[model samples]
Target: MIIVSASDDNFVPGLLNLLYSTLFHNKDAEFYIIDAGLSNANIDLIVNFSNRNKIQSHILLADKSQLDRLPENPYWTSAMYARLLIPQLLPQHSRAIYIDADATVVSDLSELWTMPLDGNLLAGVLDGSVHQEELDHVGMGNDEYINSGVLVFDLALWREEKTAEQVVQYLLRNRELIFPDQSAINATVKGRVKFLDRRWNFFSWKYPEIPAITPTIIHYTGDNKPWKKRRAPLAAIYEAYRKLSGSDFPRPRDLPEFTKARRTVVGLFSLRPKYWKIVYYTARCRSKFTTPHIRQVMARASQLDQAHPRKP
Candidate 1:
């Protein structure tokens, strides 16, 4: 299968871990790494890893001029917009799977690869944090929004429909979108998107009352990155992949000690007005709505890590 992902030097470590975890499950998968301003040293490391593993890998340099034209925010870089060039970049491929660098595959991807698109241009999981305001901002309904982190692109259809051009134009016109690429794609594609099961692109922060199945892919969304904060939710799973990938990246050490009252205050202040209602509900139901399922999922991940036994 053709698997595509984009990254720059800052995210190379996460990219390495993602590659290692994916290869562990899908050994024969081909990789297309979009080089969004990766340094020579970082490129060498990726090339060396691919060579040592004897995997089919290609690193394509992103078009800097095109990337510069896209809107960017403090949280997301121009690299996020590079996925828009996928259909153009890989004209030879009929279909491809695009996964974000901030995610790890825990199950075999062949299931996802072989799934029929049923005429949809793209397939992805719904964004857990999607708000009505975000959808309205992009002129889309709440149900139409999907996370761009994990996607199944029908490249043939994308090329035929000029989806790349449409999305780019939408983004250029709607610079105020909170999620530039995601919102643009949602608005542009509209009815052509296929919603997948939540387990496909499960956010690490979401703790369901009763998880029916283990997540096939774990995505570290938002600001609590495992590399920058040691105590981030589900960080051990990410750490396992990092160790398995043989990455010597330094561990995060400066974990701040926040008092309970201070943490509560900070969390309340950090939330947007739209989310205050949910927080209020959560506060009232904390005793009845505890997240023991998260601990169970973490334990399962820990067991899997132990079974794989990474070499030091």
Candidate 2:
């Protein structure tokens, strides 16, 4: 069975709505939900909406009690570890696909579900950022890294692998190396993982140089998301979810206040700064540097702009 996981707080409604649309599109899948910190009231609302829509599926509620009992890790949040519960919730199956809530399915996901584990512990696409030299520089093997945004796991192997325990131990022993649960998973399952096609977990940031995109599944990876200020060719994907859900999805629960304050500070700085242009260009340059695909797209766009300058 195919499975998708999400941990929600204030954005529970939007996530559920997106998942609901996903389910409607593919009727033969089961959804596993973890309301990491939401109240019973929110859970009820989700349940009632699913039921009303006649979306047949099981809901594995990671209640507050369960959330409170998880072992602590300096780099991992309860929400991230809550994903490990999928094996226990699966129905006599040794494999399942994990999709983040920030994602929306554009096509049927049976292909992702049928991906061969090949005795490897897990299967996922490699992050576009980490080159072979970079991996060596970081003292890691090339096979040891995979983006955690999308994962297909052998549940039985995961359980036997003691991944949870290993992650906790790594946190205790090497806290500095641990960024989050994904880091631990990549480290533990490294070299033993099967690599899936980039198309399955296609990050919008990875292929900006391409003139067109035909993605089966699109991931909103990195800090610059379609939901945020950066240019996203796949903004239509986000719009699809918004239109289906009748609400803007994946809205950051904690972003508005922080953004307002940040904007206010920036506005004040804009009035006083002799180096404001430097700051603006620096920010743009940083984005282009971090996500090279954007730079490629910008260069192409610049050429196009010069060839056909904006008509008055």
Candidate 3:
């Protein structure tokens, strides 16, 4: 079964639309919605939407305290890790695939679901971009971290391993500085993860680096999301979500400096090699300019609203 474990707060209606799209395109799969910390009213909205659409999938709800025994933090939540202990929660199920709310399936997930666990605790892609910093910051061995954004877990073994307990213990022992849940996962699983292809947990920044594969799932794992108009390289996934949602989530406008600089650099880099570094540096500078800075200076700016809502 393919499962999406999420709370009402992090949950978006668009996510259900994405699930509907996947079910429409692929009929052989079952989706489980594990609703953590949602009111019965909100749960009914989800269930009614599924019923109206004639979508058949299990919809389960639990309070946060019921879902996890440990205290919550920004890095780890009951919804995110519940699937890891799926065997204990739903002991009949021997395996399951976990997806983040900020993702969509482009291809059939059956292949991903069927991936050989090979006695490993988990199977997922390492965030290649963050590998070095993670290793240094946490003192982990090279390439030890795996992005929790997409995980194909062996539920039985994960329960046998008591991974959630280990993760919570790590957090307790470390004095509460774990910023990303992946850090605790890396510490517990250590050398036991089966590295999957980059296509599974494909992030936005690396989209330019690899040729596009019709991925089983596409993850919007960075600040530049498809909800914005500024170039998010892997925006087709969001576009797909937008189509399913029928919501006018307009893409934001571009900053002139970044736009002008990106164009100038791409044009220059497309030319002779000797000037490549100069043009590259200029492009980098443009990319680094903040939207707030642009908004502060430009009177006519519209498209550059903060990707994340500003804190109160």
The models' CA-based lDDT, in order, is 0.80, 0.61, 0.61
lDDT of 2 by residue, 3-38 (tens): 757665644643564575466457787776766666
Ranking of all candidate structures by their TM-score, best first: 1, 3, 2
Model 1 earns a TM-score of: 0.82
Best by lDDT: 1
Query: After superposing candidate 1, which stretches have Cα over 4 Å from the reference?
Result: 208-210, 260-312
For TM-score, the strongest prediction is: 1
What C-alpha lDDT does candidate 2 achieve relative to the native structure? 0.61
RMSD for all candidates, in order, please.
Answer: 5.6, 10.6, 10.5
Sliding window of 10 residues with minimal summed lDDT for model 1: 284-293
Report how far residue 92 has shifted in candidate 3, in Å.
1.6
CA lDDT for candidate 1: 0.80
Worst 10 residues of 2 by lDDT: 246-255
lDDT (10s digit) by residue, model 1, range 1-312: 899999998788778778877886787789999999899999999987776545578999899999998887777789999899899999999999999988877778998999999999999998857777887787666566899999999999999989999999998888888888888998888898889988889887763321444577888888767887776656666777676566757678964667854666666688855457546544433323224433444565578667865433
Kindly list the per-residue Cα lDDT of model 3 for residues 1-312, writing each as its tens digit.
556545454455445645665664466666777666667776776666666555576766554564465546664456664554445566677777777766766556777788798999888987765645556766775466778878877877878777777776775665444444567777778788999887777765554333433345667665555554445654644554454434334545665477767776776768956457554543543344223223332322122224322222
TM-scores, one per candidate: 0.82, 0.67, 0.70
